[model samples]
Target chain A: MKFVLALVALVALAFVPSFAGPYPLGLGIGVLGYGVLATAWAMFSGPTRYISLATVAFFGLGAYTVAVLSETLPYPVVLFVAAVIGLVVALIVGLATLRLAGIYFVIFTFGLTELVRQLVTYYEVNVTRTLGRYVFLPLGPEHIYWQLLALLAATLGMAYWVRQSRIGLALRVIGDDPVVASHLGIRITRTKLTLFSISCVIMTLAGAIQAPRWTYIEPSIVFNPTTSFLVVIMALLGGPNRLFGPLLGAVPLFLLFEWLSANFPNHYSIILGLLFIAIVFVLPNGVLAAGESLWTRLSRREART
Target chain B: MTTISRRTVLQGMGVSALATALSGLPVLAQDRTAIRIGYAISKTGPNAAGAGISTTPNYLLWVDDVNKAGGITLSKLGVTLPIEVTEYDDRSTAEETVRAIERLATQDNVDLILPTWGTGANLASGPTFDRFGYPQLAGTAVTDMAPDLVKRWKHSFWMLGGGHDYAEALVALLVKQRDAGTINNKVAIASVADGFGIDLSKAATPAFTEAGFELVYDKTYPLGTSDFAPVISEVAGLGVDTFVAFSYPPDTFALTQQSVVANFSPKVFYLGVGTAFPIYPGIAGPNHNGVMGIGGIDPDSEALAAYFERHTALNGQAPDNWASAVTYASLEILAQAIERVGDIDREAISAEISSGEFDTIIGKVKLVDNQLRSLWTVGQWQDGKFVGLAHTERAGAREPVVPKPAWVPAA
Candidate 1:
């Protein structure tokens, strides 16, 4: 854990310079963003086992909310405004879909995202044009990097705090056996609702952070299905069930994408796809989870001997 | 994929498009033994229709004309090297495009790289070529942000005008019309939500204001939209006379088709870019008889007709305004750059584009302050043809072609 903390701190420090150069900085910022999103997703899916798929709904709503509100205030204030909007959106979405399980949850969330995207694109709103013309924020280099860092930490910090809390215990119990948890006097529905809302807020914040990076908000990129898939894949491939999983997952995957895109062009997708398939079959418990278990077992055997 | 009749195709291509297709093959390499160039374009996908119509045909004609005139002289090798083109299909995705460029620069290692079709595809591949420092000559992509985008990523350059050209030219065309007493009404703008669409959509304010027309309706939708009923109905409700369509092929087809079905005929319908397709008129039937646009090379011009005749025979399709002319002109600029630089080293060629004078089909073209110097003109659809309607001196026809003043009950 100390090693991981030190590594993360060093990487975060190194990331400030990424904002200085265009190519390196852009890729760095993007990878960091996905890392944050993947981390949030891992907590919900790893222990909760609900397969929450409304990441898009939360992200898109948050993005538009920030863009529309920031027209009149600073991005920080706009983010708070978006959190309020996201809370309402999540409440409606959660109350309707949180009861469903497994595949049902996935499909419902998918449809919800598409609906949100369509509404954003077609529906006309009566909001003032305070954002004026530019949809992007104007910030200096240090400010953007600091904002991004703080946003990332806030998302991670909240997710970690929830995972360690009593509600997290209830979620774990619900994942293992919902009926038993109910028999044990745990209010599963209320717990799931609370978790869903929190999960959505975290995802919304991720979108808020992302909007400034592109400086343009469109229903497509915000509600992008690809983003949902990336987060899920990162979490699952890293150690899914662990706190360090998503960060670990995003590193190798993004590296693979960048390297192949730069060097082999044609073989980029082929290599990434093959690697993903290999990982899925061979590393059932993911890289960190399985590797850690193997090391612990080896040390235990040596102690016994 | 049925064979397009040469005569029928020629009837449309006439002179401008044909000459555009044939006119700009590289003057045999002055120092090297051979000139090898690469083209990265989509050979298959939803947008492939435009690629097939525009870039691919003109490429075949340009290469064929040069090869027929004997092998290209290569200055670097101190001998002329017959032109050899290696074409790769990007599958119309940004990731695929990036990968394709990497292969072109490192493996097949062609001297010149032709621009891919769409903005997103180019955006994906643009950074990779910049990383390796290659001279990329894009034939058809229109985004103002693209120049700044490439400058940030570093090396790749563009030849054909970007999206700013389309919107600015429409404003120029409308301003001319308003001054000439050709139109007296509100302006409506319809753009999509793709790469350059959002930018162009927002561009209506300046353009409409410059032309002195009140912007009545400014609407944007997603790219794959197959129907324009709801939007066109809204535009009709606004009672607009001049409509600016900032759309690509698929949505272009939809908007034009639906506008006709809705009976919402703006007096001067400005289909800025997408309707530049020759197939558009054939697709829209009589509805396309007098639509206005910004495709300078007329389909009926003599030079363009020969291009259609030859291109139809070879590539099995008719040449459209956006697809063939822009792509051909890009290659023309690229070949000329190579000739002037006298070497295949990527740095010198890129510097030449980044630094000097270039005259191509679009006339006296060059990269000024990382944007275009000229090329914001207009074209109009007359009798099922997209004719050059502005920036004359090349087929030289500039004017609007719908709802003549005689037809309007004198406002």
Candidate 2:
């Protein structure tokens, strides 16, 4: 059933390039790009850990990897390489902070993201253009969409594997109770760092994909707080613990945002904000979680009868 | 057992169903009478302040005035008809802006579309409009890559001069002064790091070098820079007489204020679009007494002045910047095209816009051989106002205020 659903989604998205107009296609590309980031974000930020807003740091790193690599190869190849590079860097980042508790890891990621943005801005402004010798290349929007799609698929697939694997159970145990897991010899620090690095790798791929989509990128887009907020909302909307939850959140929310903006003409935020606040308040586990649990309970009642 | 909650659920469903049904109700522009126009502008986030001040207010006034005068003269139909503008706020984001524009173009089926101010928002909407083949006349976006975009999207026309156009104008103004030998100007430089400024600075280098000006000090700082004391001190020490900065509102204001505070004021300060905006002069005040700017054409512009005056009188506000004039001119040109094409038809409007020349409030409007030929040129700030100063007589800024009313210095 899962494979069938995943296959259907892939087929729909594959042809999306041909059928969707630039406007719709551009929005699809954006949602998928962010969806991948949010899904990777969910790798650590599920209700288990409560790691809020850490995805942006990893996302920014991923974006920068593409910008740095795009000069040598095509953007799509640069993105693939960016995913690998992200994994490597994430390994390093995760190793350093995985020992820490909730707030420390969160703060670590925040500080690192801001630091990366500042460094990139300084390098681009002072060194890259000024030197005239070290110019950074920019990409067009269509090239960006394809790259984003590739990254989205890779990140989603990786998340699915983690969902069904032993490592996934270990991460869940760490998320549930790191103190208990430490006693059981789970090497809590090692496990966290590995997960953090993996998350960062996926984020990097998303960023690598986006560089060409907007034609121009700066620190703001890659490491934006707004992006962090959207990813959180996406993950939560999709039911953070569930696989493909971010996709559910990102696509529907983005498509709805576009549809509302187009039809109602800019009266989206008030509605979206209200909807978010209401849902979070009333549906504690989110749409996917609450709906799935209800279905499960009803099926159990029928089985007993 | 819980019929009340069940009833409430049904009620909520009923409300949502009603809302959806009402939403689908034809928001389409009704045919006949007022020619429908659409404007998508950023009105919410970071860039919203730019639009609220610059673009939207001007649009309201332009539409009102055209309505007050009965309507635009429909040349083909030979009857003046009212113009309607279906307005949407893009919420100051690229994603939102593009969505708004698509709705306006597709559903509202507006006779014309005008996108608001900023590089990011405009760039996002460019391909969308190009695909739809709507002749989007962008008023305030400084998209340097527009000439290439124009190839794919022929219907699109940019009212404001290109970034390079502005660059050459600044360089030309400095050259004219240098040739005349009043100002000790020998350098063309800037303090903007964003794409707008960097691209302009890069393009203008060859022109400045060709014109024999010394390339003294060109620097770009990050956006939201605090104290530009170091860059300023360096440029002042280098004796870089003309400080050229291409920036948006805040950065432009910051650079100017820092220059003033640091007391490193150059002799002939030139800027990109920021200098032309009315907001900048107010922010800089008398400190902006002797600056030059690269800007679009505004008629000796009683039509626009009246547009501004009426806007001020009605809303207790002045037109935000020269963008008001450009957006107003764009709609005026578009209306002339539609009316010339006669009945509501897309191809006819395109053909008319491509091969039509009609008089507008902003002098004569013509898309000669498919290029928007309503001319544009640079202007200088003479006593706080951006007075049209270059090739005005030839470009038609000449009149009773002939050669620009004494207070305006010759460029």
Candidate 3:
């Protein structure tokens, strides 16, 4: 039943580009882009409880790849290159840093973003002698929307596959108790690295798909640390443990931010910060957890009646 | 999807209504009461300080002043239409900028769209603005791609001349100082490793060498370098008579304060972006007087005085001496063009701007090949006022301050 509903919703969303104009299509593009990122983010960080802030590093690599190569290479080839780059970088970084957990891991991932940004900036300033590159691609808003929608579908499929597979069971055990998981003969590091690499590649693809919309690319714009923070926030607020939790969090929050930024530009940041604090306090385990508790209580009351 | 379909239906109705009104424009001239203008700019983010100081204030001031004077008179309609503005804060990100611009154009259906602040945002939205036939009078963007951009986007206009233009103009002034024997040909140059800084420093090095000046010291510091004492000391030790730094705001303030602390006063001291900011004088104190930077305005111009007074009165702070006036002048050009066309015909307005000359606070302004060629490239702080030191048109520039006055330590 849930799978059927999910399929229905996906089909409905797929039809948005057919009816919606530029403005709604623009918002849809943002929603779907963030959806893919948050979903992929949760795929790794959800069960393992490892907060990785290197989403933008991969995202930026993807974007910079497209910006540099899109004009000379075919779009599909550029995207594939972006994904390959993201995969290799993530594998190397995950292998090196997956041992460190908790705050240490968080700080490393955060630093990783800055490291990539600075490296790209240095290369641009020294090698290219140019900072910003103009991305004159044939892709328009509809093209971006369709591509992101398709990416979101692929991300969901992979995420669901991970959730249902033995890898998912091993990941859950690893999250529950790593020592116990080791006793159970699960290769913890391999499981974590594989998932992390996949998640990073999804983020990279999302960034590549959205780059043409920007029409210009620079280190600061693509490698903005805010992207990482927003992804984490959206994933957390939606109950990252569930398959659809990140999307649940992303859609409303993206719309709410749009409304807030539109209505109160001066105080939107303050309001957004307040809302985040409120969400953390009120929905500590996320909306899905809260909803599950409500369902349990209602079922108990119905049984009593 | 349901909500989207409903909104699309409403939009369709709105479009039909607009079409009907356009079809009966002779009868609906009186009904066209307001000219709706919209813009999305950085109001609360990394670019807020720049947008607030150089761009936003001018936009607000121009809109207010135009409405106060009974709005723009439409000679064809024989009626004056007040300007109505819808603003969005872009949060200084490309995604938000693109979305907000699209919303302004398609959702709000604004009659005209004003430019956002910065080179990237303007360039990011250039294709959109061109597709919608909106004239993009970019006041703050400085790029060598103006000629190419103008050709690609017909309605796009560049106000700030390229970095090469700025370098050549400053080098011209230095050549004059060299000819007068007020300073030696020895020069030191440093630049922040960012787009604006790199472009200027790259251009200046070649221009200075071409103009026969000895390049004594050259270096580049990263974007957010807080400590500049070492660089200042190194350059000071080099005994270079002229010190130029292509820097951003924080760096400009830091370099000036640090230079004062180190007593590294050169015969010709120059900085970049933040030198002409209203806050620079307060930060640099007495040391700001002889400091030259990227842009300048005619401090003695009567039009500038009025603009400054009005801007300060409206915003409770003085506009920057450099881009603020130019930004306001761009709006003035837009308003004049709209009035000249006597209607909200975007194509006509764009053509009017391309061809017409208008009196601006910066003086009579015209776009040659959709680029404003005549502009102040070098400015110096003189007697608490940032004054134009050199111009591309070779007119209205004040005499260069020879052997810059010693930096007075703040009491």
Candidate 4:
């Protein structure tokens, strides 16, 4: 039943570009990108209970990779290279921080993003001797929109698969008790690292696909820490435990951002912050969980009547 | 079997939410008779301070002033059409800036569009503006690639002096001072790492070296840096007699304040962007005396005095001497072009701007090969005002106070 519904949604989204105007198509690209980031982050972090904050590091790496290599290689080839780079970097960071848990892991990942940003900035100044590179892709809004939608669909399908597989059971055990899972013949570090690397590839590919839309890339703009935090907030706000929660959270949140920014540009950030706080307080488990509880309660009342 | 699954419920909610959001978007009304000018300006974010001081008010003032005189008379249509402006705050990011401009062009279908606040924003949106056939008379941009950009995008126009020209004029002034024994031949340079600073620094580095001045120190710092004490100390430690900082507004103020705190004053102190702003003098107090920066205006012109009074009256603040006057002059050019062409067609207006010269508050202005040729390139603060210093061949050119006085501590 769930697979049928997911197929219907994907088919419906695929046709959006045929009828939508430039403004809606542009918004569609951004919203789909955000959806991919949030869902992919939830894929690894939700089951393993490892709150990784390295989305920006991978995103920036992918963007810079395309910026540097897109002139010589085709964009599809650049995306492949970006995924390989993301996988390699993720493995190295995951191995080094495997022992650290909880707050230490969070801090290290946060610091890693800042470290990568500064290093890229230094390299651009000292080695490249240029402020930024201009991208001249000939793709229009409709083409970019379809590409992002395809990426988002792939991310959703992968998330659903990971949630229902044998590795998913192993991850849940590790999240419950790492030492006990290790004793029960589960390769704890290997399982966690594989999931982390897969998530990184998805995120990096999203970044690579979206990079050309910017038309120009600067290190500061590409490697912004704000992107990392926004993805985390979107995933958690939508309900990380479920396959579709991040998607649910991302669509509405990004739409709200677009509306607020267009109407009240000055106070949108403050309003967004307050709204996050409200969500955290009222729906701690997420909006999906809140809706589930509401539906169950109403059904019980209907049965009694 | 009849129960609604969680995934189905979630998909239903997602589709409905998107529908609601899209439906809520305000439809832009299309009035064919009105002269609609659209723009994306930085009302909030890193570039907002500069936009607030220079770009946004000129836009508002121009729109209001035009509408008050019963709009522009279109002899082709035999009717006078009132001007309407639709503005969006870009939040100072390149992505948002481009998105806003695209919305203005495609969604609003504005007949004409105005340029944004800075070099990067203008350059980022240049292709889009060209594709949409809007005449982009960029008011605040300074780039050495102006010729190339104008060539590539035929409808685009740059109104400010190019980076190379500004650099040559500054170097010429310093070389004259060097020959006169007004100061030592040693010079230090630092700039922000953004496009504006990078272009100027790239132009100045070789120009300073070619003029027989010793390049004592050179560095570039990232934008939004609040601490310049260490960099200032390093330059001061090098014992250079002259210092030039190609900076944005925030860093401009920060670098000067830190220099005063570090007591690292040079014989020739020149900063960029914030130097012509009234707030700079207000913050630096008496220390602003003997300081030099880019984009000087004629301080004694009666027309400028009147424009300043009107700006203060309309916006409750004085405009920056550098970019604000050029911005207003660009609007004046646009207004005259529209009136002369007797139509609101983008191609006709662009051709009028390209071929015709017009009188403006900044004196007679002309776009030679899609670039302005008449404007001051440098300014100096003397006796509580920023006076014209370099590029004196233009109108409002004044002799500079050579060998700047030593910096004074605030009382």
How far in Å is the alpha carbon of B88 misplaced in model 3?
1.5
Better of 1 and 2 by TM-score: 2
Interface Cα root-mean-square deviation for all models? 16.8, 5.4, 9.0, 5.4
Question: Which candidate should be chosen as best, given lDDT against the real structure?
Answer: 3
Ranking by DockQ: 3, 4, 2, 1
Tens digits of per-residue lDDT, candidate 3, A14-73, equal 888888877778878988999999999999999999999999999999999999998899
Candidate 1: list runs displaced more than 4 Å.
Answer: A1-36, A56-100, A115-165, A187-222, A233-239, A242-305, B1-116, B119-139, B143-224, B230-244, B259-267, B299-314, B345-347, B362-370, B392-399, B404-411
The per-model DockQ list reads 0.04, 0.24, 0.30, 0.28
Model 3: fnat (fraction of native contacts) = 0.49
Runs with alpha carbons beyond 4 Å of true place in candidate 3: A1-12, B1-31
Specify the poorest-scoring 10-residue window by lDDT in model 4 chain A: A125-134
Worst 10 residues of 1 chain A by lDDT: A125-134
Q: All candidates: CA RMSD in angstroms?
A: 11.7, 5.6, 5.5, 3.9
The weakest ten consecutive residues by lDDT in model 1 chain B span B1-10
Q: Which number leads on DockQ?
A: 3
In model 4, which regions exceed 4 Å deviation?
Answer: A1-12, B1-29, B392-396
Per-candidate count of clashing residue pairs (backbone under 3 Å): 42, 3, 0, 0
TM-score of chain B of 4: 0.91
lDDT tens digits by residue: candidate 2, A20-135? 55545656666777788778888777724746566776676666666566678875587677778778767776666667677886777677777767776678776665311111
Q: How far in Å is the alpha carbon of B134 misplaced in model 1?
A: 4.8
